[model samples]
Target: MTAIRDDGSERDRVLANGAVMAAGTVVSRMSGFVRSTLLAAALGAQLHADVFNIANTIPNMLYILLAGGIFNAVLVPQLVRAMRNDPDGGDAYTSRVITLAALFLAVVSVLLVLAAPWVMELLLDSRFSEPALAAQRDSAIDFARYCLPQVFFYGMFVLVGQVLNARGRFGPMMWAPIANNVISVAVLALYLVVFGPAQDVFGAFSADEELLLGLGSTLGIAAQFVILVPYLRSAGFRYRPRFDFRGTGLGHTLRLGVWTVLFVIVNQVAYTVVVRLASSGTASSADGTGYSIYSSTFLIVMVPHSVVTVSLATAILPRLSARAAEDDLPGLSRSLTDTLRSALAVVLPFALLLPVIATDLANVVWGHGAAAAHYELYAPSLALFGAGLAFFTVHYLMLRGFYALERTRTVFWIQCAVGGTNIVAALVLVRATDAEHTSPALVLAYSASYLVGAVISYAVLHRLVGGLRTARLVRFLVRAAIAAGLSTAAAAGTAYLLHRAAGDPHWVVAAVWVVVTTCVDVAVFVALARVLRLGEVTTVVDTILRRVRPRHVPS
Candidate 1:
């Protein structure tokens, strides 16, 4: 009975925290949609968008490649340990981390700025070197130079945000990205107002245009980092420059970080290959979509993961680490497995429904100005990404388990397989298709890669944890798939009938169809979940119900 009560309490705490982060993520994503839409409206979805998108994106890719893996996965557990074991409650360690990270980011950001031309040369394709496309490629390199400074801000934002997370402050980190989105929206809006939409989809941006878009992007990132400062202070993190890196346990953290750094190296290398391939997709064809379409659709597919799995895992990681610290493998396994089931209970439905709504969803997102004519190009990649996202959610959670166990080396090796699969598949798949099929092919590569990742990571973590309650997990997966399958069929049937009834409806009507279909899908899924008695489903549903249910007052 006590154990049941404890589980309930744990779930409630996790759900409450998850809810806050999810709400912030939802808002941030909605604003991000506006931002992406504006981007499409301004630049169209082909070479023009790809040039700016890829250039502005390099800083983030570099940041992640350099430090994000260690900061995100490795440091959280280490910070948790410091807080628990250190007499000063990890303040010195946290400060040292901040100081060292800031120094690293500053130096790396400077070098990256110097190497911007070379970086663009590596990431863009051979087609861009042609005389006709040389101007566009130069424009991309210019944009990268302006945008590389964002590496420092992005690293700091995430590093500080992780500090907050380690201190049991999660909402601020999730919420602070909204500031970045809002700034981006403003920047794009200003671009539209000043320069208007790009006249030629395949044209290069002028110098002035690059200045606004590139510098504006860096400004947004800086603002995002600034927004976290107050929150850091409020979270009781007083930042002092602790230069005494010796005898301060920094070496231990760095030792653990080596494999994680290698992990990100593999990840970023694969991504660089993808970018190179994607860049060629647009340059090789006048009207074909590439990096921009691939990235935007990928984000849409990741909405469930960003909202549900990430938030849930962030809130649960501290507890899992605590269990591991106590050497309670069974307890840690139980919590990890339970969290996995709960997350999949929410994510599976999204995977099934995405394809049904892909066309309409694309219309709603990219159907504006210069983008409207090509918005449909996003649908195939979008549809394929749903499978990828579901696979990635599983892989992501399994990595958290490994992190908790300080199994960074194992995670690195697993990521190598995933990354290798992505690079090989992308190289092979893209070779077989034209420009139009590029994004879809890449999506297939992504899905296939993570399927490999999910299987390997889960099996390894299961063994490491003595058992990840595999029988229970398999049963839940089977039942959830059944429920989600029926729900998807119902949703698809409704969509088909609605299409017949409305026959080439406008965006408003299409949106109405999506709403009605989603309603029916959820209703059927809930009914079936109840019938199947899936506790994970019941726990989430009942918790939501309890939140919205009316409460009687003292009167």
Candidate 2:
């Protein structure tokens, strides 16, 4: 009975933490949507936008290539172990880790800024070197110079957030991004007020305009990192410089991170290929199809994953690590399965219905200011990305499983397979298709890559754990697929009828369809879940009610 009570308490704690993280994620994503919308309005989905997007993306790519993969994948488990066993509650170790990471990232950021031009030339499409795109290439270099410093801030934010997570604080990491998005939205709004939207191409932007955008973006990242410091203090963590690094188990941590570094290198190689392909579309005659559109659509598809899957994973990872540390494979397996089911219960419906209403959703989100004309460009890729959402979520969760087990090499090899597939498929698709039409195909390749990743991850995880409740997971997924299909069909048919009756796809029509279709789809899904008696659905509903309902007052 005591064990059962403890298990129930643990379950409740996980749900509560997940709810907090989910709420934070929802706020962050909503703010991010605002930020993206403002950016789209300010820049439009053209070459100028592509240049800015690509330049801004380079910092993150560089970070992953250098340190992000290690910090993200290896540090949490190590920190958790330290917290549990170390005499000082891992304080000195944490400080040393943070100090070293900051110094490393600072050096990397400076070097990257100096190397911005060469880096741009290497990562960007060859079309940028052509006489027509020379100006765009130059602007990209300038933007990179300003944005590259964000690598340091990005590393800081993730390291501090991981420290918070190790101490069982999850909400701050998820919530901190809201401040970043808010700052970015304000900057973009100011840009719109001042510059009045970018002219058609990249060459039209002046130097001051480039500085405004580049510096504003970097400032937002700085703000994101700054806000987390106080939270770390509030969590009883104080920053103290610890320079003594040798013989402190830091070597072991670094050794564990080696494979993660390789993993991210492979992943970045694939992303570089995609970036080249996507950016090539900017040179095409298509008005709104390019890297910017692909990136924006990808952002939309990730909303559910970020809000649901990431929240659950963050909440459960420390616990998973604890179980793995204890050699409690059964507990770890149960925890992972429950977390996966919970994530899919929410994500599967969105994945299914998003494609059906992608156009309306895109218009509703992006149809404002100068962006209205290009809103339709986002739908095709959004739809394609939606198809692979579940697979991507599964793959992410499986990677976390490996991280908990400290199996970085296995994770590295799996990413190699995933990245190899993505690179090959992207090359073929880009070479075969017109640049203007490559967005959907690129998205398809993304989904396929994850499909391969999910399969490989599941097989390995199943074997590692002696069994991952594969039969149960398979049955649950089948039921979910069935329910999602019926929900999507119902929603799509309703949307079509509504569109026909409205006689147009105006923003107003799109808005109404978004509302009507989402309602009908969710209703159908819930009804099917009831009829099917899906346990995950019940768990989700009960958890939500538990969160929202008023508790009885104690006498």
Best by lDDT: 1
TM-scores for every predicted model = 0.97, 0.96
User: Per-residue lDDT tens digits of candidate 1, residues 163-266?
Assistant: 89989999998999999999999999999999998899999989999999998999999998999989878888799998899999999899999999999999
Considering summed lDDT, which 10 consecutive residues are worst modelled in model 2? 1-10
- The top-ranked prediction according to TM-score is 1
Which 10-residue window in model 1 sums to the lowest lDDT? 1-10
lDDT of each: 0.90, 0.87
